[model samples]
Target: MIEGPMGAKPEELDELCELVGKVFNWQMRENFPTLFCNDNTDNLRIIKEDGKIVSHFGFVIRDMIINGCRISVGNVGAVCTDENYRKKGYAWKILDQAIEKYRADGVDMFLVSGSRSLYIQHGCTHVGKVKNYAIYRGMPIPSAKVKAIKYTVDDLPVWSALYRNEPIRFHRPYNDFLVLTTSGLVYRPDSRLFSISDGNKIVAYVVGSCDNNKKSFGLHEYAGSRKAIIASIPQWFEELNVDRCVVPVNLYDIEFNQIFHSLGIEPDYGTTGGTIVIINFPQMCERLLPLFEEKIGSHIANVLTFSERDGNYVIGLDGDEAIISDPHDLARIIFGDPPILEAPTKIPAEGKLLDVIKAIFPIPRPEYGLSYI
Candidate 1:
């Protein structure tokens, strides 16, 4: 198989897209190229067999300061395998190559919009969970003196200033900000910043895109006061012309549930957002240890255990005398089905599997609407 970046000729891309469409049973959109080759061109990888495209995966390598230290990470996406070549191990081969390339390129961490199983096999650990929150059309929004408007280019400088001042937990390039605001997806009512002003200061603003056929709006970003956020909900809904709005929710927050309940909105479904596997243990520990030391204190000496099998990772955490596995595995025990622990193992009296799950897979509360590769 031939492995390389977007330097492939135009005819090569068309052939690849055609193969992807045939395999996935969906039309590969014309916009797929922009998704892969835009700003982050270095991390893209394509697999070709005998001069014909077989599988494709896209990724972005970015460096971010986490807890005061710069850490390099690879964000993966746009994964697809040609259907005619199924059961031939095309995906595994491509991923194997990609992971090696990422390591060679000096990425210490990897994250993707997939399940724990996908990255686990690649020596990655499940460090977090991402859940989608939805507000139905009938939900009652609390009254507040907040306002919102569609985003515009003139507002970019101000928005960029605000974003840089209080950066979101996740990483995003400035160009992505421009793309989301200008593309038909995210909307702002006026040329100037469409925002709610608390007297003179902007309080809360909603940034998102809509899927017309599904009548659903996906929120990419939100900022400002809680009161402003609640007050602007109705306008945000009407602007998108959608019956429901969805945003990612962190599992740790009780406030999210309270807000949804108070608004008379019930979530339609909650799916796994992304899978994480710890590749460089010491590096990851070095980066995140201080945060744990300061926030959770030193009650538990954290040690993570991970295994690779079946093209997925099976992650387990050991602390003191306790052992824990999958986050959903723990959730099933507490909420619905029996726990999926493999055998009798030591666990903390108060340390539910969910706690370990949360520790390994900490979900970031905010949503990233920009489809960056």
Candidate 2:
């Protein structure tokens, strides 16, 4: 067996691609290429045997500003393993190496869009759920007054500016921003690139792209006053002329949910949601302290113990004034299932205390967005 970092040879990438295609029963369009090439992010690892790659994973290094502090994060993607190598632990080995790399790179948290069970084994916890909502093409316009217009290429700057101001969390850089603006309509191919104008000034806007089939639209991010966003929806729908339009939902955002509800639309499919593992508890706690302080209006204390057993977690929460001996037990009461918790004992505590801890250390289950690896 051989294991190493990818090199500069194109032929090696070709072989790796063949291995992935065969294992996954998919075809490679142009062979394989170094994932790090031309991409600003550098979180990739590969496993090989006899110069033939057997498994691989990729990550992108990102920095998120939380409470005025920038936290380094690793977003995982491109997980694939050769079929013949299955059950031989090649995938586990590559993931272990990736974890070590993430630690060395000073990442405080890691995010992924894959099997929650597999990730939990690596100390990741369920953070949030992701939802995709789509409106089929030719579906009668749901009664909302908005204009749809074609977008051109001159609206990049406005789109980027709008994206930077939105409150949504982003997992990558915004350099690949592109904008298509025409007449009074705009299309953002990349999240950061957008379109805007206030009656004439720059009051409202929308940001998204057409689907791979070119017959539908996917809205990854959007910001502006509620009215502005509402008004632009129909315009976007008309411009795309596709069978469907999709957007992600942040379930915690009540206002966002309310807006969607008022529109008389709902999501089509459901999935487990997004996952985040807190690798550095202290760092994450410190970063979230201010938010907690603001929400609770008092100092907070808690002891969180996380253990891994048989690819699952055994968590214990103890605070100065309260105790939650087993998170799994608590899960049964709250979510009906211990989720991925390994222990089943429940701890009794004041409902207020439970609420406070939940607010601060929210297990985010985010709706999946339009963008995927």
Candidate 3:
């Protein structure tokens, strides 16, 4: 009795959660309330056999800002298959269906929470660049004139305001924001939210958790002033009483990176936030027009176009064009690849075209943080 690579109906929700909990050993409805709710049945793709759902793949759609431009992104997670059904291609089939369904629904990209072979073979790549740095306690870095206080329900307005200031971030509606901060338990263990304040005014906030086994504090998400964010680290270290604090710095965050460099801390460059698949490159380029204008001029940004010929990408400005032979390389060009790569994709343009591509490209990739699906 094998049937369906189809959408999960509302009635199948409890069964779906049972399968998810059986696989992951935790209730999906509890950890990811936003995604596994009764209303989200349509987004859950599944395969049923022997009178039960044996395989599942789900995604939640949300709009995210990249340098002020909003683009639809599908946050894919909770993918699972019954142990008896592994290697039968059910997961792959469901993934293909999900992509097709979402693309037609106008989703520009997908951000999977896992970098498994299933995602890699489906054109999802780990091209978003970041640097991981460990700052040990008693480091010479000076603490700022700020106090770090645990976040409370009363601070929701200011918290949302500070998060909105992030140039590249999720378009989290108030309800979603509240749900994520309060209920998103998938974000490591014992995670806590703290607001950094200068006297009475809140300047920044961080959401992270301590790993008792690693004996370290991890800074997962932060917003507001980069300087304030950096200055508040030492205070966190002191409060947590950890020997080390692990910080992931986005490659495009120059000021934050510079501050770390000033402290003489070397970074280990790596790919973060799982793999990504660019479903509609043309739509991505179209939606990013504002970011392009901000980088170059509107005169040049307005003329840019993106298209796919065969399996390669064609990026054009005015009448000049550059062909990207590999989709992975094209993604790296648009976002970023690790700095340590022996061979990274080069802009295949010359003169003004090259300059424009360099100035605007490799835009900051949005960190999942609390928005991790």
Top candidate by TM-score? 3
Superposition error at 88 for model 3 (Å) = 1.9
Model 3, 1-373: lDDT tens per residue?
A: 9877888898989999999999999867878877887777888889999889999988888998887899999999999999988989999999988888888999998999897888888888777677888988778875678878988777778889988987778898898778777766745658879888888888888888888775798878888776777777777777777778888888767788898999899998778777788888888889998888888889888888888788778888778988887666777888887565678778788988888889888887778888786
Listed in order, each prediction's TM-score against the native is 0.65, 0.66, 0.92
Q: For residues 322-368, could you state the per-residue lDDT of candidate 2 as single tens digits?
A: 33333223223322222344553333445665565555544332222
Model 3 accuracy (lDDT, Cα): 0.83
Ranking by lDDT: 3, 1, 2
Please write out the lDDT profile of model 1 over residues 137-167, one tens digit for every residue: 8776777765676555766766665555433
Task: At residue 185, give the lDDT of candidate 3.
Answer: 72
Q: Cα miss at 54, model 1 (Å)? A: 3.2
RMSD from true fold, candidate 3: 2.2
Q: How many backbone clashes does candidate 2 have?
A: 29
- Predicted candidate 1: what Cα RMSD to the true structure? 6.6
Candidate 1 stretches with Cα past 4 Å from truth are 1-35, 63-71, 82-87, 115-140, 165-168, 183-202, 209-218, 237-247, 252-272, 296-367, 371-373
Q: What is the C-alpha lDDT of each candidate?
A: 0.53, 0.50, 0.83
